[model samples]
Target: MKNITDYSGKCVLVLGLAKSGYETARLLKKLGAVVTVNDGMDLTGNQDAEELITEGITIVDKEHPLSLLETNELIVKNPGIPYSVPILQEAEKKAIPIITEVELAYQINEGTTIAVTGTNGKTTVTSLIGDMFSHSSKKGLLSGNIGFVASKVAQEAEPEDTMITELSSFQLMGVQSYRPHIAVITNIYSAHLDYHGTQDEYVKAKMNIFKNQQSKDYLVFNDAQRELLELYTVNSKVIYFSTVRPTNGAYIKDDAIYFQEELICRLNQIVLPGKHNLENILASIAVCKLSGINNEAIIATLTSFEGIKHRTQYVTTIDGVKYYNDSKATNTLATKFALDAFNVPVHWLCGGLDRGNGFEDLDDHVKCVERMYIFGQTIPKLIDFAKKHDINYEMCHDVKDAVSKTAKFTKHGQVVLLSPACASWDQYPTYEVRGEDFIQQVKSME
Candidate 1:
């Protein structure tokens, strides 16, 4: 802890009490802030809430009454809670300082931070960077969007520790002055438009990762996004990474990944699947090299590491048919990448919450998909795409159903892939839950 007394005697309201909310409330209370938690769900018999209540933290359940804002000087909200919420909109009117847990983490953190944000690949890159540091002399504390709440990890981290945080657009929008020492925007694309309401606003939210950075800090950007570079101005020292060609930062030269001029590893040595992962690898390499990690440690981590769970993760092969769980796709671009990774015929399982977007972008990418196993709220949307493309299709209730259907239809040398190109909220609580369901369903077949 920074021994910072800045928050002492302040009235702080923590909106939406999930894992992040629980952590944030406790942290604020320790800082001498009078904390009040507002959760839409009933917290009765909730052990986490009970612990907080015993500790003198208040809990207001069922509704977010705008009256709570009258007492709260600051609002630390769960990232998923929209600003369109009545209380949040009123807070904006009252000029209350609203921030996500990430901002609070940034304020009290003793560790140097390396934050990553993108449409895709951020989780993989963040995790890989953490692994790289673990293999090297330095320590990387993984936090934020990857699962471990940023505030919780920051409390334990020391000055020597490096925080490798994976931030989402939702989290970034709440930050006021959360500047990391090294920030990376792997690659931005159209995503979470339902939350942001526009592509430009979504891009703006992603841009917040580097907005507060100073001249001494580094911004590791995708060199391929010339349009993004042209449109957005980065004030920090820019280090570019590319899967295309040579760059000042990390780049592919002669089939090997390099940071500046030094070689890190060859393309063939990497075990992680998908060509899209090459961009992630390059971004990770840039961050590691910037942090003074050696090529040996970088190469070691890259070669030994398999893909992240539920992100194109290879499941067991049953009767010569391989299964992969990529429930974290949640968008068309990610699904396209997952589809492109396989050369063999794929029993493509997809569909989820209907964001009212067309799947025309994936029209050309479904060439290798032998059949489409559609499920969830977006089934009709996916079915329309399949019909238009003259592709084989089947409709299912959810991921488990899709997996079961896929197993029956898949043959020798073919693949069963659960890469839902939509949010998991329609059927499951999280993408992890949906992926676990798919995995368990596949296991039952054996």
Candidate 2:
């Protein structure tokens, strides 16, 4: 990594003025970089843009003026901005070094950094790792794809602190020098094909999480992931987490959660449920052990942890029906895992932007689904799946209607789960927003 202190007087162009880009711009500006931020939105006295403008950071909005590239030493691309964009192409022509904010955050961070990435459980493992650090009395700031930008946390990071981050394939694809002190891959699965162009490319993108790690750096991984086992190689010192076998890192055997040779806790003591969650817990335990957290603290955190807001979050129980908000399940594999977590009959609130991949992937799990409330652009595709699987289903306008409709069919002790096997881009901007909408709609039932 280049000297972060040398950013002063360097010309840095930040593309996309969303929270990620905007914060990167601020950090660059703080480092004395002559920074310019661009977004598709027109410049206005909108508080955030205006605040940056007043900070003497240039805010160019509404369009990407290619001419501005003449003097740039670096371009920081937001994870959301596609490389196919003309301005980015122009930057490539100019041979400008482009990287995500996390890369820059790593360049500037003095704290020990831990990054978690995978197709399904990044958020859960990331949150649990951060919680473990909190119980160990270490300062752990959680960030990245969970809504906190890494660089935003880096600005306040001290050497004594630790940074726990959740990374997505998009963020990892653009990373250049963003190696973590401790890196983790929960597991890899086919996801984000739309952005990655292909499964191989997506797998390669995720493997970037460990690209720069050295032998001294630690890699905690899911030993049970066949996809990971078949593809990708890790150079860092590896510690494995699994449910099937004894591992050097963490594992579960006969209901006991073990770290290395020691028993951390029993599986029944865990507050979070499901086999996938057991995988998440094992991964989190491995990370916590690497961070030197004691077993008692780890067990305490595990017993109290209810999981993050969206992924299988229990919203409420009304009229003997339990509603779980898993709006974060943005792909079929995630939805499948969510289903595997529950043995009870589920009235699933599913569907979203159709990726054309169809429902063949989730066919086996359809038997557990008592009723499917389909919604969004993928209604027809899911409805077809419902028919093929011979499961009862109904079409709904959105999450609100899905919740209301499911309520009528849900009897006591049944589950109304919002585990969309598709992304939320069709109806809402983010999964967080969609999950909030689902929570509000569920609350409306009373």
Candidate 3:
């Protein structure tokens, strides 16, 4: 993607009127692109569409017609629209340059970018990196999959600034020439299989983060993911972060975070619990060091930075029972980490869209869980695990139901954790919405 300032008279189709699509359409139109927006949802009363209509941008809703691609020079796709979508498949046949909103941001992004892609911890790692920039004299913007769209951030950015982007595999897959000065892969897991179809395709899409990177660019990753080097070709300089080995990157040693023999912070200094979170800190350390940030600010940021919202965020204590909202743990692996973070007996609430996932691995983690409340579409599978382990369990219809049911099981000094090991699409559109609902329900108990 080039730094295109003027799209004057350029024909572009912004597919899907999702957050990224709306932002992309607006930016492109402002730049003088002949932009037409398309979405599968009806635009009858959509306030989002109404705003775009005032700009005179054409809107095609309910269906994606092949004729919409006619005379189009570019297709800026919303990452949420799967590759299997008819329009995207048709775009491929016509050789239209298909790209995500982030790709468009890459074109106009004047600032240096740090792109993070992985199954889990991407949000936490990206937010931690943002804190590193914020706590210091350095300036950067956090956007992308973590909530804010990248195009919106890049539009107002200056060359002196940096963009800390949290990218998903879906977002990365449509990238063509989008290269980050610093690329981070938190860790690859077998997730989003329902969308990507296969683990290989998912991994390939994630590896796209390094595709356009030059030799001078830095690639930060888990030392555990050395297979990323073995599995895919990477030309950028590799910087690793780990709790395992202590070389060529930032790592932990003697309970202190280190960047190649340089001490950043002790484990106790970081307010975030869980060893997985320490890995996030390690990634931030490597990024700050590469960006020329000092150790003091890095350690200071680690000391005060509470975790991201929706992912292990603290809600409140009711009747001495502590509640943590980990609604962002959309997979078994992520929920496993959440469970491992708490050492006390738990009244755990989990379940949601199955996505064809297995909970067999979760059986071991349930040892700390005193009772489990299964929720959403995966109740039967989760119930099987509860029965297998002989752990007390019940079922719920949704997040609100789960939260209310746990109230009955809550005990003083016990933990009530909402670490659903499945996606929230079965109940809520996104994890954030699901998390907010969980927090709301928990608060109502008081």
Return the TM-score for candidate 3, rounded to 2 decimals.
0.97
Rank by TM-score, descending? 1, 3, 2
Q: How accurate locally, in lDDT, is each candidate?
A: 0.92, 0.87, 0.88
lDDT of 1 by residue, 1-446 (tens): 68789799999999999999999999999999999999999899999999999999999998999899989999999999999999999999999989999999999999899999999999999999999999999999999999999999999999999999999999999989899999999998888888999999999999999888889999999998957867777789999998878999999989988888887878899988778988998999999999999888898888899878999988899999998999999999999999999889999999998877779889789889899999989887888889898889998988877787775678999999998999999899999999999889988998
Identify the runs in model 1 with alpha carbons over 4 angstroms from their true place: none
Q: Which one is best on lDDT?
A: 1
Query: How close to the true structure is residue 278 of candidate 2, measured as C-alpha lDDT?
Result: 86
State the lDDT of candidate 3 residue by residue for 1-446, as single tens digits. Answer: 23465578999999899899899999998888999999888889999899998997989999999898887889998898897888789889989888899988988888899999888888888888888888888898999998898999998788889999999999998988899999999899889998999999999999999999989999998898797578778899999888977968999889887898988778887887787888888888898899998888787788888887888889999999999999999998899899998889998889999888798767677779999888898889988888888889987888888888887777899999999999989889998899999999998998
Q: What residue runs in model 3 are displaced by over 4 Å at the alpha carbon? A: 1-6
Q: How does residue 57 of candidate 3 score in lDDT?
A: 90
Q: Which should have the higher lDDT, number 1 or number 3?
A: 1
How many residue pairs in model 2 have overlapping backbones? 0
Q: Give the deviation of candidate 2 from the true structure as CA RMSD.
A: 1.9
